[model samples]
Target chain A: MEKVILIKYGEIYLKGKNRKFFEKTLENNIKNALNEFNCVVSRIPGRYEVSGFDPKFSSKILSAVGKIAGVFSFSLASVVDSELEQIENISIVETEDLDGTFKVVTNRADKTFLKSSMEISRHIGGLILSKNKSLSVDIHEPEHILNIDVRENKKTYVYVSSNDHKGIGGMPVCSSGHGLILLSGGIDSPVAFFMMNKRGVKLHAIHFHSFPYTSNLAKEKVLDLAKILAPFNGGEIGVYLCNVAKVQEAVHENCNPDYMITILRRAMFKIAERLSKDKNYSMIVTGENLGQVASQTIESMTVVENVVESTPILRPLVAFDKTEIIDIARRIDTFETSIKPFEDCCTVFLPDSPVTKPRLEKVVFEEAKIDLEKIIDEAYAGIERIIIKS
Target chain B: MIYLDNAATTQCLDGVVDVMNNYLKHDYFNASSVYAPAVKVRRDVENARNELLDMVFASNHKLLFVSCATEANNTIFESATLRSGDKIIVSAGEHPSVFECAKQFQNNGVEVCVVDLLPSGEIDEEDFARKMDRRVKLVSVMMVSNETGAVNNIKRICKIAKKVNPRVLVATDGVQAFGKIDVCVDDLGVDFFVMSAHKIHGPKGIGALVYRKDIHISPLLWGGGQENGLRSGTENVAGIMGFFEAAKLSMKNQKSNFEKVQKIRDEFIDEFQNSGVKFSVNGNGSPFILSLSFDGIRGEVLLHALEEHEILVSTGSACSSKHSDNRILSAMGKSQAEVLGNVRISFNAHDAYDVKNIVKIFASTIEKLKG
Candidate 1:
């Protein structure tokens, strides 16, 4: 008895003229994914064949391939000679316990074979019926349909309906580029990070923490956020933690409470823009929702935007409501960590009656009171780069 | 430094900020109130709505503002599928909001058919035709491909869909394409068109769904009858104002900005090609999105490497970034290596100068990797 595995390409079939390139790439990817199986993988026309593996590892290999990006669906099929007698014999033996309504669906690629598709189906169908008296053929509605395929390699493969799980078949990562996510240990930011990542954006994270003002728990929450984001980002997060506590504290001490958030936002933008410039980030992604909070007000947003010389800020959750943002955060497993009662630098000096609608002129006036450049420099000085390995 | 990911979200325009500031300071009143401040708020709301109508080129379309695109999408799905056993057909690739909402009908025994996509990421005509039958109560597709930047032939698809099932409502998730592209619901002939303010440089927490007057949809949220009873909640007046301004600006600069970004995209592609790097573009759908697949290096690795140089790109869609699945690239038949190596370099009109620098960085990084 020869054991064979049938592999199917998911999104590769849609590649049209460039199908072969993708197929080859998928083949290589499958081999790499199944490297531990010690199996021989061979491309056989429409499908690839995996043989000579420890039967014990066959399911594992298939499971791994199922997780591979380019693979659509796969199955372990029984490979037999193209001869009708052999196929019939195998079908009879395989369906010995079958007591349900069954039909044979056959695909004959070898035209030279004497039997037609319908005739083969009838013959195979009759053989199964003869083996089990309780089984009846229902052409339109069969309880189980045995699928048989004949290939040009002078081989026929038959399989039962068992293993067909959907693959997350999209374009591979690095097929796009990288995105720098402004990760706050808040619900909205991580959800925003996940949303952008779903579209195939490789992610690097920027975290703002005030060391003395905010606890290490805040940093730990962010690190946990990174770890949660790591699997999707290929197992690591490049975190740039800027301690804006001092600068924020300075703004709180010097500026009016209403202007504190606006000034602090400007400083954040300065740091984000500088980091974006240094990182060549195409855009800065934030978790800000419009009108969700005082700082996210259009007026405050403008003040923050004015500080950044370049780098478009990507606020994926900008238009999302609190409930929607929280829903996604919960879905992405970030809600628990985000709700851990850790106050970030942005929250430490938060005024009780923070201005909902801060005037741009007032913000500018308060901003003028502080040496913005020096504050930015101090914030940059407090920057810490940490690599999180998940 | 240049910011190019405007289609993702835009900075708040100065005028929008001023308007919001004035409203927040002196006229902060709930629109539902009949009192002096409330009357002022109501007038402002009406003014903003009218302004938005003019901005999007939809003066007559019924506009219902929601929290965001996701809520708008959910509203359409929940409302349109009120009839039992109604079928819905959605494009294979839509924003998660639209796609996930369409999947909800499946649980309700409402037949859901996801139309196939062409290699260019457009809706497959044959597949669309095949999926369109009497059972299909509504057909929803996106105005643009968020991942590939592929602008869907909404006008054509809508035409075909209406031809097949005149009763079928046509909805488009215009989140990515609204401001970036010329979005006139009347011109596109879509029964429902959704737009998110944040995508167009407006504030977040505000989006609108424009429903054709003839089409009726149920309200997803039940609250104070705001947004013509289609959406009920405290209106996000500031966000809406910002959205209107952003929409207006995007409309005003659409052509020039598109051309500018096209030039940058061309330069980046040309430079990458000239550098002799083992790279391939994932989708030939739209110039707004450029997905490049590099050999050997994983996207995360290159992402961090480029981060070291202050270059930010994306691996795929930002939504699925945290998940190990690269559905778009994988759907494009990208291998693990290729999928892992994929990065998206999206640009807006303001991104003209960034491309040149990006080209240089891309060349140097590829060279470094090769060395």
Candidate 2:
């Protein structure tokens, strides 16, 4: 009484040339799913078989395998060695109660098998109908169908039906290169990180904390955000906190108050770009929504863009409204921590009336007054790195 | 490190940890089991219940354990509205669990009315009184707001609700106020009260709902007849014991703790005032929680700045922090930028040392940013 669970791949079969990749993926998925079942999963030619388990665990293993993503369907089957006399006996036993219209589906992958697929199907169908007087031969609308699959390795699998489940399948996080996220302990950045993770991009978060200007709760909020992002990225997320108060102070003393945000954003970009380059990240992800604030305006954006020479800046939520962003944040569970009233560095040195739109020439004129590189270097020097675990 | 996010969850006291560890290691038993060890666990649970009842001055009320304040709130609202057409009136500043649960009644044809909050984050008492009509079946208000820390006049509101319709039940979400302030359920004359263990230095997954003895409500879960047949699941004996110990500790040192934290809050506020920082306190109510808005700086930026100093505070209630629009602050009519720059600093009785460090760090950061 050798019992085996026969499993079939669903959508993976649709891939023509890349079928092997899909098959391998599905095989791995099934193996992982059946890991707790303590069964040996062996790959046969057209399908896979689960063996060496208690016969009673067959139904449970089949149901579990069917639910894994990349798996199309599965069935509980009986495995028998390739022997003509044994096949005939097993077929007789399997078709004893086939008291209805019947059809036989056979796959003869094993060329060594003397019986052809058509010959096997016809013989099995006739034998099943002869056993029960009420059964009629209906090739199309068969009430019950028997399946006989022969593999190249001289083995035969007989099963009735296959069952299917959904999966959270995409590329694993970090499969794509990493990106540095300007996580601002607010709703948008964490949501942005979540969005990026969904697309398989791993993240490293950088938080700008203005101690003495903002409370430690603000920093904790960023850390909390990092922690929330951790599980999705498969483990710990690296977080770097930079003290921007000194830079902001230098900018306020050396530059115009209205240009404070512009100067600060440029400095942040410089540091992020430098770190991104250092950490081998291809881009930077920010929570900046266009026109959401003075610094987020087109002019301000252009001014800030002028500072970053390397790495493309990815603003995933640039077009999304606050409501839309918040909705996503709520769905991802970051809305709660984002709504906490922790002040970040951007709030610490905010000018009462920041330039929502400023001429490029005027921005350049203002930039000339401050030691831009020095400020960024100073802020970069104060960077405190914390690796967050999932 | 300074921790001013007590409203989100507090650090446990040594006594709470000791009590919880003792229960976890030595008294771990299934209360429903017939063994003597189980019986002892049941007795301890009952003893803790009686102590809590006495502390709240609600010996007559029935206390039921829940996972958290969210579960407690959901159970009450869901049970109360089991009958169709029951009207639920809630404050606009109510916690999401309460507000959302009340809103859900709309699907069952139960009318939900939201009472507005004043600019000070206090409920408009007159407005609430006017809204209390014969159709209202329940009035749910939070005793102290998790975000603004505005203490509502629960006694006054309950009185008004009862005056309009004696059958109108009053439920108070006391997650923020329970341990920090003295909450005498009978003194306030509420029909139901909810509190979370984590908010008062206990474990995360335990909370309680104290229902008036005579209030008729249906059970949410159908299982073994546990929690007086309200919530039916195996008791989290360890969490409950920890909660009791934390509650006891909070009650014992609440006054001195309050005074100590209040001084730090005042000092922090004074620095902002002296620095000519253009800011406004969200609610002019309790000193336990401070919602400060600094003009020019985004709240997130300030949050990161403070993070550099190893200080931990929040922008609002941790639950609602991830959203950009501060519904609590916005309900009080704060401008978009004003709401964006707002930060919440909550203190517990045990946070004096941390509070001083927080104030010093905050002052210096502001000075640096101001330069």
- Over the stretch A1-390, how does candidate 2's per-residue lDDT look in tens digits? 476777766555556886676567556656765676688988877778888985445544554553344444566666788776666667667766445566778888898898999988887767766666766877888766677887787888775532222233443355456999998987888988877765557789998877878866577668767765675665568999998887788778877789888878888888999999988999899988998988889888998888889689999889999999998786556786688765788888789998898777887788788777887787787788989864
Tell me the fnat of candidate 1: 0.00
Candidates, DockQ: 0.01, 0.01
Deviating ranges (above 4 Å) for candidate 2: A1-390, B82-84, B354-360, B363-371
Retained true contacts (fraction), each candidate: 0.00, 0.00
Model 1 lDDT tens row, B183-302: 666557788888888776678888888876556678877787666566788887777767777777777888887777777778888888777778887766556778788987777677
Best by lDDT: 2
Against the reference, the lDDT scores of all candidates come to 0.74, 0.78
Per-residue lDDT of model 2, residues B1-371, tens digit only: 77778888888778888988988899988876645577678768877886787667673476888899999888788667545766778998988898878877777788888888999998999889888898888889999988888999999999888867888888999988877877877668898999888988898899999998766657778898677567899998989999999888878888876777678778878766776667889886566888988787778768879989877888887887788788888888888888988889887765445434456677677667767
